[model samples]
Target: MITTDLNIKFYTYIYKCHPHLFSSLARDGQIMGLSLRVRRRGGSGSKKEIIPVTSCSEEVEITVPSQFQCPISYELMKDPVIIASGITYDRENIEKWFESGYQTCPVTNTVLTSLEQIPNHTIRRMIQGWCGSSLGGGIERIPTPRVPVTSHQVSEICGRLSAATWRGDYAACSEMVRKLKMLGKESERNRKCVKENGAGLVLCVCLDAFSENANASILLEEIVSVLTWMLPIGSEGQTKLTTTSSFNRLVELLRNGDQNAAFVIKELLELNVAHVHALTKINGVEEAFLKSLNRDSTCVNSLTSIHHMILTNQETVSRFLELDLVNTTVEMLVDSENSVCEKALTVLNAICETKEGREKVRRNELVIPILVKKILKITEKKDLVSVMWKICKSGDGYEVEEALRLGAFKKLVVMLQVGCGEGTKEKVTELLKMMNKVMKMNGFVDRSDSSSIEFKHVKKPF
Candidate 1:
């Protein structure tokens, strides 16, 4: 009776403590006679296999190595990192200990001189190897851990970079900035930590201090790379960074072929263009902005910047015209994806607000066909119709004639028939009226059969 009680107690313990093994045993109908399997190497050059042993007999014990376990959790250390006190602890547990408002090391109970945790790669590799060899089929191996970086560590790195820049130590500044770039590339969490710890302000200050230094070009590029990841500074930081001097520096870097500087400036422009009240104050910025659009990665942002620039000051439109903005946007519209095409068309409409913009569109031979082609092809019918209306409304009926010849009349007729939003329908009706008037006044007959006119390229939606 005493042996039966002990067996019941053992079964209960297995069910609670090792549910996975218990489930396997129950599935195999071996719950009554408890057994455990441990993997062992068969022989040299032979395959390994699991051998079962009775739990009641001499049971094989699996013990965790003392060094492989965390000092606080006493569990196996997955991500072992050494604190400033020179004691190793798992990254997650140490972070929790710090977050609990303890400035002292959990193991030593002494004040930590610094919260910096360097990864103990040697110990981690040892643990991984032991997990692979000894634990075998019993436990899964520990994955190589991602190095954990705290905000305090990031702040220290930023401080060091700031100090290096202030002391004019370009080499040290370059090294620290590269370190930051490495950390920033490690993970998104690291990037957020860098930004939260004032990396943006520090890097911007460094750029401002060393921008004119001829020897600091490479260092400045490294700073730009790090700054690219820590984009979107807060409003207060935005107000401080988006000054005339900052604009000039970024434009110069952009002209010098640092594409990331363009990206950084793009974010800054997006954050707050309030500082950019005067467009002419910064020279060649419009040209540089237009030039960055040649690359696909920066095209969306460059278009956004141009949109904001034109809206901020209508006079900037003339500058963009001189830089071939109309031709560039027209070319982009043909190959750009839906979102980019929409933005490019929006910019064209914004440009069309002026007489020069309308004249540019009227002169471009491909403008009418491309706009009409987009009618049946693109999804945003509202923007498409809006630009067409602006063109016909501004011209001396020439654009209206060209649009009709390009089958705009048929496309619009089919669009109205298939149904569109009220706004698009209203605009399409207005365009049809303008085109019919232009055709009649130009001695061409407007017949109801135009909708039935077979189009070579556009099929009737019906």
Candidate 2:
């Protein structure tokens, strides 16, 4: 038997695979309450018997009335609390909202004078009564809410964890990491409590201290796991988490660490992609990524991430090109994976926007053939076509000759006939016109009919 939550994934699968059944289920109010089973014959011949398999449909449905639901969680409230803005919410949800540094009630949008949550005893009693009544449906009754963690408690824990880390007390550090992970997992309110009380800063300190220590990988992994949940706090928090030492350590891990460490670093980079300009500042970052690519051609995630990072600024692009990334990109253009080809094309197109980049591309021997072969196969046809056109417009006679010799003109004509977007068709037509002019000037016959290429000659300076 299999059990799962009736979440968005379940609904999406049903909607996509069985739309009519989903519609009927929704009309019959069975959308919120599903129970499905698949029976198959098991064992051989005389011992054959039916075995039932259960899916997400086995989960019970809890239909809480909207009024009884917390605005933040949209679940039934256990301890309803009123705020200064005269709006009521679940104690845990509202506390998390305020602890995360919000100053207004979620519903009223009114400025709050105080963050105190006054417990609504009457509402709690009414909800309990409702849950016990016949209208409660199959939903379980709300239990008494536990008292939230105080800031003082979190600060004390941080001090101990920091001391343990600095003293090289791995055991103590691991224990604290375990406790903090538990607290973070318990509720969003607890997570905010952990962050606001310096959990993130403490974790960064531990990461810096234990990074170089021998046999510290386990401890570092624990710290990273705990820190992962405290992310995206505030700008100050982000700045502290992304300090030079910490950022470099993360990059180092990305290059050499185990799978778990690599996962943590990847996630960190993704979250702080905008703020990690320091990654580009580090020497050999591009070289290291290219080396990894050379070692493993199928690593699409690393390839895509590197391309995204390079596309962030022109300086990074220049540095990337300086590392001879153009040839590597050309190699990737022919990769069997669609994603590899697409990302390689995106980076190549970005590089072609600069004069030096265009010059380098025009000089490469494999540039034209690789692009011609992959242009129709890759999803980024527009970028590929744009790069080809730019190279053709480079005004180098040899570049134009090489492109024509490689059958680029025929590909453009085919793209036009097969029907692409109007913008793409216009660009393709212009290229064909330019290629036709060049071929005629060189005493080569324009085998492509000009009438079929339907666009006025928009002359661009060669």
Best by lDDT: 1
Residue 40, model 1: lDDT of 28
Candidate 1 global TM-score: 0.68
Clashing pairs in 1: none
Q: Which lDDT tens digits does candidate 2 get at residues 347-438?
A: 77888888888887777767776776665676658878878888878756776665566567777887888888877777788888887878
Instruction: After superposing candidate 2 on the true structure, give the runs of residues whose Cα lies further than 4 Å from its correct spot.
Output: 1-113, 117-156, 178-198, 224-248, 257-287, 291-342, 349-386, 389-434, 439-462
**lDDT score, candidate 2:** 0.68
Give a tens-digit lDDT track for model 1, residues 1-462: 122546656766776688788678768866545444433232231432233332443335455666777878766789999999999998889978987999998877899888888999999998888867745323457899676568878889988988998999998888888888888788876887888889888888888778667677788778877777777767655644565665677777776767787677767766666655643468888888776776453367678778878877888999999888888888787667888888888889888888898788667766776787778777777777888888888777777886777678878988999899998899899999988887787766444443333334642222
Q: How good is model 2 by TM-score? A: 0.54
For model 1, what is the alpha-carbon lDDT of residue 156? Answer: 90
What lDDT is reached at residue 451 by model 2?
Answer: 23
TM-scores of all models? 0.68, 0.54
lDDT of 1: 0.74
